[model samples]
Target: MSDQEASQTSGVIKKFLYVNRRAPHGSNYAQEGLEVALIGAAFEQDVAMAYIDDGVFQLKTDQDTSEIGTKNFSPTYRALGDYDVKKIYVERESLEKRGLTQDDLMPLVYEDEDDDWEEKPMINLVTAAELQDIIEQSDVVLNF
Candidate 1:
């Protein structure tokens, strides 16, 4: 078996790249998606969560989750650091037209500010080329 396959079976480390592409609380799946990410982290797997396209909504600032009366698990995202799985990245263009600046998302994530703003979520954004590299590097990928 390949090292990655062997590792996965041996329970050594399974590197997963989680692709989140929905708004938080917009649907029940988004919340459940976060749960899966955390569960993977707890298993001591190397997990990285990526917010692409509309998935950026999952990391919006000042998310007043009380109306839902559901636990705001967004805060728990920070706790992923404790699991040593803290590579959270949001798409640059995704942050722009949403009227969200980098600092606007600080508490939620460490996003980069030096990029295009006031653009469509898909315009002038990181090319799929970049994402391909990330996908190739990960042992497995889960989409939400």
Candidate 2:
């Protein structure tokens, strides 16, 4: 069935969690996961994304794929807010282990429509335990 049909029939907004554990460029997992999340959001699902392990690097800024002969898809992340997929959780442990900080990541933000469209940060630095809780709360979990 189509997304609109499914939504009209069920009228249920499910919480979808897309978990990323792979590096962004080496394979297709990260990119595919991102595409799926955007599609889910477009379907009016409550979409959230989690970055863990090497996946945290996906959010890092200033990615240059020119030398590698790969298209730089990192900029697409900034568009998540437009899709209403604003809950982007970055695992603290993952960043620490890689000697990275939140500052190293892209500055993603969203406008709060209910609050006079106030711009707010979208990337949330979360503990492993907190991320687990979020995972538990999700209705569907997609792993990459």
Candidate 3:
């Protein structure tokens, strides 16, 4: 095989969407969702995460899980970049209904190697309609 042919190949790349509608720390859903997302990224699939309802709290800054005797894993979302899972869609209405703005959330960013390590925001504040479209376009939709 030619060197170029050896370097280039195509495989089944599935689009995975993880829908998080539950509050973090209330149950294992958010944490487990993140775990699944990381696993999907490790498989080199196209993965996107959607935070709706109370799930928006998952990405909120200043979470004090210590009060409840559980370790806060909010920081793990930031590491999604290392795994190439960049798309994190936060439902705008969910945030507003919860009295949260984009500034209330953690700034999740990833270094784009192709862009000379330029930092890019991973959290996408999307509308309900937009989020619906995202879900419709995904090949595999996993709701938690």
Highest lDDT: give the candidate number: 2
lDDT (10s digit) by residue, model 1, range 1-144? 245654565657767988888887767777888878766654667788777777877766677888878767777665555545557767776777577765666353232234432211211234356666777899989889
Residues 1-144, candidate 3, lDDT per residue (tens digit)?
Answer: 344542353366889999999998979989988898876664667888899999999998988887799879988988988889888999999999999999999998889989999999999999999999999999999998
**Which wins on TM-score, candidate 1 or candidate 2?**
2
Stretches > 4 Å off in candidate 2: 1-10
List the candidates ranked by lDDT, beginning with the highest.
Answer: 2, 3, 1
TM-score of each: 0.71, 0.94, 0.90
lDDT of 3 at 141: 97
Please give, for residues 28-143, the per-residue lDDT of candidate 2 as tens digits: 89888888877666577888899999999999999999999988899999999988987899999999999999999999998889899888999999999999999999999989
Predicted structure with the largest TM-score when compared to the true one: 2
RMSD to the hidden true structure, all candidates: 8.5, 1.5, 4.8
Clash totals for all models, in order? 0, 0, 0
Pairs clashing within candidate 2? none
Give the C-alpha miss distance for residue 32 in model 2, angstroms: 1.0
Clashing pairs in 1: none
Clashes by residue pair, model 3: none
Between 2 and 3, whose lDDT is larger?
Answer: 2
